[model samples]
Target chain A: MNRVRRNKTAIILFIIPTLILFCTIIIVPIFMDVYYSFFKWNGMTAPEFIGADNYIELFSSKAMGFPRTIKNAFILAGLSVFIQLPISLFMAIVLARGVKWEKFFVALFFTPVLISTVVIGQLWLKMYNPQYGIINSFLRLVGLDNLCRTWLGDGRTALPAVFVPILWQYIGYHMLLLYAGVKSIPEELNEAAKIDGANSWQIARLITIPNLKPTLQVCTIFAITGSLKAFDLIYVLTGGGPAHASEVPSTLMVDMIFGRSRYGIGSTIAVFIIFLCFFFAVLIKKVFKTEVD
Target chain B: MHGKIGKGIGNKVIFVFLCIWALVQIFPIYWMFTFSLKDNSEIFGKNMIGLPHVWRWSNYIDALKVGNIGRYFLNSVFVTVATIMITTICALLATYALTRMEWKGQKLANSLIMLGLTVPIHAAILPVFIVLKKFHMTNSYWALIIPYAAFALAMAILICESFIEGVPRELEEAACIDGCGVYGIFVRIIIPMMRPCLSTVAIFTFLQAWNELMFAVTFISDSKFRTLPVGIQTLCGSYTTDWGPIGAALVIATFPTLLIYCFMSEKIQESMAAGAVKG
Candidate 1:
């Protein structure tokens, strides 16, 4: 009894500082986000309780076009899972099979993942620079000068322009994750398939892809959640754009709090984002849940 | 015979394809570097793609001296170091208590942390901003450091949990028999064993708080307290046409992270992979 009590006191001593910080910063804010979502205050005055009106406004406000932003996030998630993951998967498969200088290419690809996103934003911003940027310069170099308008300034192209760097930067992260998974797969499986005359494509499709589904699910969750949280790059690149063309929930949340001082609406957006993130996370897990067929 | 030839061709194709992708990955950074070394003439002139004719070493000086990047760099370094030390120690303690010691509320604490891993900081920062504003912590170092440490706790604790669980409890028994208490065992036994996970956790936390933007951009309205991301954002904004110094500022911001990653890529990569699998 004395020993257990002593250990209990020790545990409390060990846990309190972290417990206070984490709970205050992470847990309390979540509840507070929900609490503040009901108010209509400017974040300075005492919050006037408005009773879900902010949520109503969030859903109905055409100007916010929050659903559009949510749609955009989902679109990004789709592209990430379908386009980005496949590219990374292909690279992982190739690297796993056999390639000289494999480690060099892996490090090269993953370097961008380690890079600070703000710097990446700056790099891409310069790439999308109107006058002397590479994309425009390349267009001119290829005699497609007529196609070059301001990539970021033009709303039609801004989202895709922002998406491209995001796609490039994170491919290696997913590639690494999938590569780790690929590396762990039994080599005998591959050798047996090869002995049975499976081509590289067939071996990958038949053996590797099936085994990689769980890792793919992890990459999916990361890609989706990451897309939902996409702010810094877009914030630096377009600041949601010349006209809110690339606005995501994160940027829009910043806009609400700091830009418009609509703290209530911002909290409302925050609450919705939390819900969407949870929804997608749970949904993805369920989709990837192993079924005993 | 034909199959061997076909396989050889396929290898050649995969090699070329990978080279193109690697070039795509590497070129932007190299291009950024070259422009960082060019003057306005060379950057805005027809030499956009080529190497800088005259290396403008002054771009670094200009960016640091004029662009507020130096001050922001200091701020980032301060916040990053503070966040790392606080989070690492706190997470180590909490994870130790949870995993290695007998404790009530362990399951609850673990679940709360799991919940935290899912709670996006950006999504919840609105209220946190309000809370900080109420306390006048805005624009203060505490605002960034405290939150950075707190936000990092979830992942750091989670990673440490997996590692500490793998640590054999037999050592703790031996220490206990030698008159060591829980704290003594944790400090002397578990801490030494946790070196690998601790480094990974430190690197992860460092990268996170260093590169963080949303909170920095929002919380620190004062330029003096601004970190590298916010400072670079504004600097790049103010100097849109001056690609040289702006790229230099970016290169400054990107340098330390790229250096560390290049040196310790495998350890970092495996840790991140471990994190994903554990999740």
Candidate 2:
């Protein structure tokens, strides 16, 4: 058995294919992204190396709006953590306490996540349609006609408007994670708290929330990192316009590469986005760590 | 008794809230179905929320015929199927080697593969385009499949690794002692035991490749090789005056996923929860 398990030929044969593919397609491209960021190439000519210029321009060039996109992403992340997670946590706790149609609600809530982001974007597009959308129609019927404007067309509203559906789509996802965490807490722990004259709020705050620390940490990381990389819905809904108001790093990267042929700048944005994700991921883990210790 | 009454009221409030949230979650899909069957006037006019007056089912036909969504659908299916097969097979075999086999750099290799999870798809776009262009693989199905499979591989391997770890070594040892070789033990013993894990990987891969918009849009410009999400976006662009056809295209694109979820929501949820730990 030991001899068979240590067969070098079998091991090499089994792992080599994936290792090569993963390297070429995933790992190699990441390094290439970092490498390409230092060069000024238009995708047609020989690349000219301009070390750190792209990065410098990406931050200092006001026209690039890179900082604004990052700010927009932070706002989205803020809303996701503060608003979306609480709603999900509320739903998870209620359902975990045993409710009618518990399984049904879970399945239903997760349906949006199953559907493509493009489809969700389109649905919300119609829902936000100024002339005949349900939102405008309701606003008109209720005599708040002033609120009826092109939600995706106005620069002031485009960012938040795009965020509504993006946030809406993921509620069930966070809820499911927290739901699993809530369910995994032993029933006896809750029973003991109850027997000690702890009310439901006390039990939830002390027992459930602390017990859910790991899951909450994971959820926070996902929400923050996901916000940093948010692209599809914003692309579909606004394309980072009315005037680049809704641009996130991912969309800005796409615009740089395809829209303007600024491949080097695009790679710079890509690298920045990657850095932000790793930075936030580590920061979030630290924050969650201190709370537990 | 008063406390019991208060508890009843609380449950009632919670139920109502849950129902409302569920409705908010599902209303859009239901609305999509209804609006897909409505013409311009009904969709924009009084019949927005209620049932369509005419139920113009020809909108689906129009989407297939005029919008050319069928070609894109087939393209998406082909790409998604290839991605699933490549990702699952590679992930399973590599996981077997990583977990069961003794090797010098096994831990290092496992960590490297796991690191693939942190590398977002956006980070690879520009460089991959350059790589694909060098090979002249752009505008081909392989362009989409190779990258999609690569991106999905890490998560699939993670899922497979956890499942394979649970299987006792006794089975493999017994098989080996009974004259089975490494290949024989892997195929005859391990592969059969990995059905659930494989399915989870397949489903997760399907979700990734099927709805992928970024790479599909970036790499493949040829209409002949375009996938559903891209096609649907184009359909939306072209049919700006009339949205019923766009809704129909969305439904057509969404149907397979919804159908899969209907049967395997539990599996999908479990897989997503596990795969999501990468973030």
Candidate 3:
């Protein structure tokens, strides 16, 4: 009994500090996101309870353009899962087969993930500059002048242009996840396939890929959810720019919250993002679970 | 016999693929470096791929002259280091108890901490902002430090708990046999055994806090308190027309992170992979 009491006290002491911090910083704010979404409040005034008016305005009112932001975010998520994941998986399979300069390639690939996203935004902003930027200059060099556009400054090109840096920045991250998974597969499985006259692609398809399914699911979930919450790079690149061509949910929320002081609407946007993240996360798991069978 | 030639062709194809991908990954950073040293005319007029004509170092000097890159660098160093230290200590204690100690509510505590790993920063930024405002702590170092440490605690504890669980119970038992108390066993056994995991958590926490922009941008508006990401964003905003200085400021802001990644990439990748899998 004495020992139990002592252990209980010790555990509480060990856990309470982090518990308070997590609750105050993470958990409480989620609840508060819901609480504030019902009110029509700016940061300054006492919040007036509007009770779903914010949500109504958020969806029905076209002025906020929240629907457009949601579409943009989903587009990013789609590209990440389809275009980005396949490329990363291909690299990981090849790299896991053991290549020369693997360490050097891995380091180079992962370097961008280490740098601040804001810095990456600035890097691409320079590249996309209409006048002397590389994209336009290179286009002119190759006699593709007709194809060149103000990559980030034109609404026509800005959305896709914003994706380039974001794509570069995180490719290594997803690649690394799949690479670790590939490396964990037993070599004998591949060697066994090879002895049976299976080619490299055949070996990868029959032996390696089936084993990588769980990791594939995890990487997919991460990529999709991460895309849903994407902000910093977009914020720094264009602030959803060229007339909000590249606006995403997080950027739109930041604008509503901070720029216009529409706390209620801002909170509504926040709640929307939270729901999307949770919804996609759960849905991805369900989809993956079905795939396993 | 045919397999050997086929394998040879396969290797060649993969090598070509890798070289193109590597170029795409690396060319932007090289391009940034080249432009950082160019004058405006050289930048606008010269070949887009060429090195700076004069190797002008003045861009760096002008970048510094115009803004608080130096101050922002120091603030980032302070906030990141402070956050990492506090987070590691808190995570270690909590993980030690959660993994090693016998107690009630262990399951609840563990589940609660795991849930924090998914709480997006945007979802919580408003409440944290309002809470800090109420405390009159916005734009203060504490404002950034508290939230950074709190959010990071989940991942830190996650990584540390897994590592601590692997540490053989025999060591702790042996230490206890030597009359070492709970604290001594932790200090002598758990801490030492968990060094690699600690550094993994340390590097992760450092990078997260260092590159973080949302909290820094929103919670702390004063230039005096601004960290590198926010400071550099504003710096770019002011110098939009002048690519050279903005490029220079970017290179300076990014160099340390690049350097660390260059040196410690394996640990960085391992920690990231672990985080993704465990979650």
Candidate 4:
């Protein structure tokens, strides 16, 4: 009995510090966000009591409303699922199939994943620089100078321009994940499929694709959530500028809270972003029936 | 014989396609280095993608001296090291306890940690900022260091637990029978055995700290204390674009990470592959 008590005390000593830190950093902040969502304050002065006004404004088409930001997030989410996933999966399949100098190629592809978002934003910004950028220079050299418009500065292309870098940085990461998934499949399965007269494409489509469902589900969740929470790259690239064309929820929230000093609205946006992420996460989980064993 | 020919052709096509894709992947980094070495005129010259007219090595020198690149580099190094130290130690201890110690609330503890994974750092920015202000930690190393450690705990704990699960408990039992205490056993027997995972944690923590931006922007106010990402932002002006120096500064900022990635690419790839499979 004495030994049991002693062991319990040791466990408490071990666990308490991490538990306290987690509660302070995570749990409290979530509740605070929910609470602050109900009020209206600029964070500089007093918070005015405004019940459900922030949320009601969420659905309304007011300037700095939540609906538009959510719409942008949805669009990004769609791009991630449809565009990013397919291309990254294709790359993963190709890369996994015994390329020469595999290590060098893997390193080259994964380099962007290790770079800072700010640098990537800056690099892409310069790459899209209208006059001196390689993109425009190549266009001119190929006799298509008329087609080269200001990529990031133009409103129509700003969101897509932002999406390109995010896609570029993360496609390698997803590819690596999918490659791991492909490798985990038993080699015997591939050999058996080959014995049954299956070609490479046939084996991959029929065997590899079906078995990669769990990995695909996880990758999809990460991509979707990552797209919705996208901020630093977009913020650095354009600061949601060229007339707020690339305004994600996180950026809009930061602008309101820090730039505009509207705390309550910022909190409302934060709360909304949380809900959106949770909604999508839960929706994906339900669709895929993802469960931890 | 026909089937063999077709298969050979298909492999050749795959090889060519991957080679082109590899070029696309590496082109931007190549452009960054090439542009950094060029003068302003060459940067805007007609042969933009061609060889630089002059290899202006002094641009790097100017970037180091004039652009405060040295200061930003030092700041990033300091912050990254401090964050890695705190996170690695805290995560190692906490994960060891969770996995090996006879804890009463192990399940609840694990569930709470899992909850931390879903709580995105952005959602907590406001309250954390308010808390930091209350403690007068804003603009201090404590501001960045504390938050970096806190936010990283979920991933560290997850990775560490996975590693510790694979460690043989027999070694710990042997160490205990030889009069080693729990702490001693952990230090001597367990930690040395978990070097690969520890290095994996260290590298990941370093990369995360090095690449972080939003928190630094939000929490830091002083120019001297700003890390590379935020410092690079101030290099740009409202109207004018200093293409030469900005590109140079970016090259200086990015070189360390690139070098590390080159050397440690295999290990990083292995760890990431392991993470994906385990997940």
For every prediction, compared with the true complex, DockQ reads 0.68, 0.74, 0.66, 0.57
Local accuracy of candidate 3 as per-residue lDDT tens digits, A1-293: 22422466667777788888888888889889999999999889789999989999988988778899999998998999888889999999988898889878877887778888888888888888787887888888889999988787889888998887887789988998899999999988888887998977788898889999989988988898899989998998889977789999899898988888998899889888888888888898999899888
lDDT of 2 by residue, A212-279 (tens): 88889999988988899898999999999998989998999999999999999999999988888879
Q: Write the per-residue lDDT of candidate 3 for residues B202-258, one digit (tens) a residue.
A: 888988999999999988889999999989988988777787888888899988887
Off by over 4 Å in 1: A1-6, A290-293
**Candidate 4, A1-293: lDDT as tens digits:** 22322366566766776777788887788899999888888766788889998878767846765666677787888888898889888877777777777667777887888888888888888888888777887888899979898988999998888888888888888888888788888999999998998878898899988888888988888888888899988988889877888888999989888898878878888887787777877788788874433
lDDT of 2 by residue, B126-219 (tens): 8889888999988999999988999999999988988997888999989888999999998898999998788889888998899899999888
Pick out the ten consecutive residues of candidate 4 chain B with the lowest summed lDDT.
B235-244
Query: On residues A1-293, what C-alpha lDDT tens digit does candidate 1 reach at each position?
Result: 23832476788888999999988888888788888888898866787989979989888999988888898888898899899999999999999777988988988998888788999988888888888888888898899999998999998999999999998999999999999999999999999998998877788888998998889888999999989988888888888876788998889989988999998889888888888888889988888885412
Residue B160 lDDT (model 3): 92
lDDT of 3: 0.86
Q: What lDDT tens digits, residue by residue, belong to model 1 across residues B1-279?
A: 438889789889989999999999999999989999998788775688799998999999999999979999999999999999999899988887787666667898889888888888875577678778888889888889988898888989989998887898787888888888777787798889999898889888988999999999889989989999999988987887677899899899999988888788888888878877767
Query: Each model's fnat?
Result: 0.71, 0.74, 0.68, 0.54
- The prediction achieving the highest lDDT against the true structure is 2
What TM-score does chain A reach in every model? Answer: 0.96, 0.98, 0.97, 0.94
Query: Which segments of candidate 3 are over 4 A away from where they belong?
Result: A1-6
Q: Find the 10 residues in a row with the least total lDDT in model 3 chain A.
A: A1-10
Better of 3 and 4 by TM-score: 3
Candidate 3, residue B219: Cα displacement in angstroms equals: 1.6
Window of ten residues with lowest summed lDDT in model 2 chain B: B270-279
User: lDDT of model 4 at residue A178?
Assistant: 88
Question: Which scores better on lDDT, 3 or 4?
Answer: 3
